[model samples]
Target: MAKKKSDGVNKSQAIRDYYAANPKAKPMEVAEAMKAQGINVTAQFVSTVKSNSKKSKTTRGRASAKKSVAKKPAKRATRASKATSEVSLDSLLNAKKLVEEMGGVEGARNALSVLEQLMD
Candidate 1:
């Protein structure tokens, strides 16, 4: 079967209607919808149209940053958070010193011996 070429209109009226009914939809979504409905618009064409529509709407509009304030945290864990899994030598040293001042070397050794157990 042969695919008929579009008549080379500036804007496909069907696509405009589809977008009007589904405002805020992505270009890919429109492309998929057109494909499923057996229309001939390409994904690139849909994307281009969507971008043009957005550009026209925002020609005199304020910058997007002025509309909303958003703070999105990084998705990956940081080095400091991973440090939680490893016991700090400084913490262990402080604990040992406290124990020894209260008693003696034996108390310090006891504290060091139980460091792993205490960390858990």
Candidate 2:
């Protein structure tokens, strides 16, 4: 007699098949469906599997893949862009390092001003 295969063995592929049958099904819905059929799985686990599948199918490296993401079409600008008021601690430290590299903040500003003048 052949040994029985464990339900967990193909759980991710099962989830994908379920998604194909019900295009609108969420990860939680997939988990619930599997539970109804006596297969135990959590929604989070299903989500992780689905995400991993997507990441695996991407042919491009991370940087190019990120850049290729589709953006919404431009809309009319009704308001001026707001300046960022808060700086992250990490960003502040990075900026401090950059300033040191350029001698000081004044030196950095001078370099930026030179760049701006060149752009004009």
RMSD, every candidate, angstroms: 19.6, 13.1
Worst 10 residues of 2 by lDDT: 72-81
Residue range 1-120, candidate 2, lDDT tens digits: 998776445777788788778877888899999889777889999888777766745565533454466654444433333585666665566566557658779988998899899999
Quote the positional error of residue 51 for candidate 1 in Å: 2.3
Model 2 global lDDT (CA atoms, 0 to 1) = 0.74
Model 1 regions more than 4 Å off = 1-11, 55-120
lDDT of 1 at 15: 75
- Candidate 2 lands at a TM-score of 0.40
The top-ranked prediction according to lDDT is 2
**How much lDDT does each candidate structure score?**
0.66, 0.74
In model 1, state the lDDT of residue 94: 57
Residue 55: error of model 1 in Å?
4.6
Error of 1 at 30 (Å): 0.7
The number of the candidate with the highest TM-score is 2
